[model samples]
Target: MFFTNPLDNKLRKWGKAKQELPASVSAMKEKVLASVKPKAEPLPKTKNRTPYWFVLSGALAALVLFIGQYTLRQINTPVADSGFGIASQEQMALSSKYEEENLASDMVTPNVTPSDLGIQYGEATGLGGRSYEDSMVEKVSNFISTGQDRNGAISDAREFLKYDYSATIKTRKVEQISSRVQTIVRGHGGRVDNMYVQEKHGYVYFVVPKSSLEAFKNEIKGLVNVRFYTESVRAQNLLPEKVIIEKSTETAKESLASLEGELAILTKEHNTRISDLQKQLNGVVASINRLRNEVTTSTVRQEEIKRDISRLSAVQQKLQRQITDENQNYNSQKFYLDDRIKNAKSEISNLAEQDQNLQDNVETVQGSVEVEWVSIFEIIKLYVPYYWAWVLSFCAIALAVNYFSKRRTIEAL
Candidate 1:
């Protein structure tokens, strides 16, 4: 092999008989290798080696975060497809149902109402009794409140005292009795509730409220003959007990309806458990029916059970008498037949003894048969169900009442 290196020629000239390379020469070879070695191809473009798993992981993380946010949003706000909020829906429904109803008062408010308490008090003074004029005219004016009403209020006062009045011992009608009667009543702040003519042709009866009653009677006194007639005056105050249970029950019903509506939406959209929803609907319907039955007014039923019982007893007595009569007749006939049979048996025995040859034909048969008489017990047994309808009706009413009371309590909550 021919070598092209001039270094080898120089090495041959200096070499005495082919000396082997020393350790230093090996070091020099290593240095030459270090210098001549080609550099590696820059780690095979490692920056571009982004792991497929890393990208996938990043996308997955972002998707998970997005889903989490969506879930949170759905929970916080129930945005319907129509975009109207629940409050708006409630308002619209209220308007449609009640026709621009006044808004319900908030729970936070104190007691407020339209009614005011009325009172009347007075002191008696001077004579044995106050003048009839003062009691009828002045008292009414003081008692009635003019501030409560804006419409022209009445002021009951006697404008005229002297007026025509006639008294008749005999029954008669005077064409013209008094002119001041109408004027006096009109002057006093009073209105007539009702006027009645007494059995006596000349007597008149008037009934009115507290402030108006006195004036009304006084006016009548002025109109007719002033005779000493029984004038009775009495006052009555009615006490009212108010129950708000109905309103409470109504509110609960509305809440239940709202819950039902939400449940319906869930069923329509998400296909939620239909069985559970149907069960709830059944419960609600049952509650409604129960309440309705409870609220139904019951009418008193009148029956003549006593009369029916009395009639039945009479029939039973008649049947007993007939049975007794039949028994007595049967006993009498049985006793007569028994006597006849005894006589015939004796006659047959005598015949047997007297005529031995004819004894074979002398046999006697004597017996009595009884036909049972029909009884009334069977008839009453047949009618037992018909009469028990009243009892059944009572039980039904009781059940309805119980159902209603329980349902009302539930609804009120």
Candidate 2:
């Protein structure tokens, strides 16, 4: 290698000197090339097994890649609701509950009730109460942080909103971070609604008091490295729904009150009618007693009085039957009306409960957190400039390729 130095040729060319080698050096070069070109004792012919070797190597590489990919997928897949790092009861229940509730809230059902009565609220409508006014207010709010005073402009003071926060963090301690998040949430007067954890990743959903949302956010920010943190906030205005709910509640209450009033009036009328019938019955009894008490000297007159008494007794029996029938009918009607009143009261109660839930949503904020395990290499990458890393990697690969090519060339010679 020292005999054929590349730098010697370049230096000779630059100095404008002769480039040809001496006769002795040329002869030596020829001898070396000739010796390497021929093998001793005429080597036996070998079969061309290179293709088979290449095929085998390719198959092995493919199998290795496939197994690696499958193992990675298995590692990344989330476990069941009751699996590691999960709040079993809370997570399972909330997962199904919130998914259904969200779907229901997104659907819009037309006002099936009479338009004159306004929009209907309850499970019948799937809980959608987004109106044109609501849309306008939402759009306007998106442009302005606060509202302005005007004759008919809506006020933000009573605007109800449901807050949702989401964040993704990369850290080595996924389970530890998940547990810490749960603790922090609880400490902030919140509860974890759902969670899932794996060796390398985790997820958690929680709700905290809106009054403590800022504090909760700051604490969460400190849990993991801020450089690997990604987050977003979303809010849904529920003022229009609240208005509709209030109206529905009021309507239900009025209906209940009306039914109660009708019940009272029916009771009073029923009593009055029964009282009148009883008085008439008493009068009939008095006449029969008086007729019986009277002294009759003639036999014909006594017989006539007895006949009149018998007729009055028959009339009294008919009146008693009429009173009995009237009482039975009154009881049936009162029962039917009372049932209706009961139903109305139940509907009102349900609406009131829904309203209270809405209030609670406004008082609290929902949050979702995702944690991922970041390896040491990834941590180093965060501080290293991306372009510089790529350049260095390319240089290393080029050097390896050049080294392999030179080795193969020398063996061929």
The candidate scoring highest on TM-score is 2
Off by over 4 Å in 2: 1-157, 375-413
Off by over 4 Å in 1: 1-200, 203-209, 221-229, 240-413
Specify the poorest-scoring 10-residue window by lDDT in model 2: 143-152
State each model's CA lDDT, in order: 0.40, 0.75
Candidate 1 — worst ten consecutive residues by lDDT sum?
234-243
- Candidates in order, TM-scores: namely 0.16, 0.56
User: Tens digits of per-residue lDDT for model 2 on 258-365?
Assistant: 888988998899899899989999999999999999997999999999999999999899889989998999999999998998899889889888999999989899
The digit string of per-residue lDDT tens for model 1 on 1-413 reads 34666877767867955767776998898888889867677765546777899999999999999999787544434222133312223433333333212211211121323122111223332332267545433434443433222211135221211111211111123222222332343455423232233333222212222344445555554443333111222111110000122233445456555555654554454333434444554554555444444532334211343344455556555555655655565566556645655554555455445444222222211111111111244223234535457678989999999999999999999
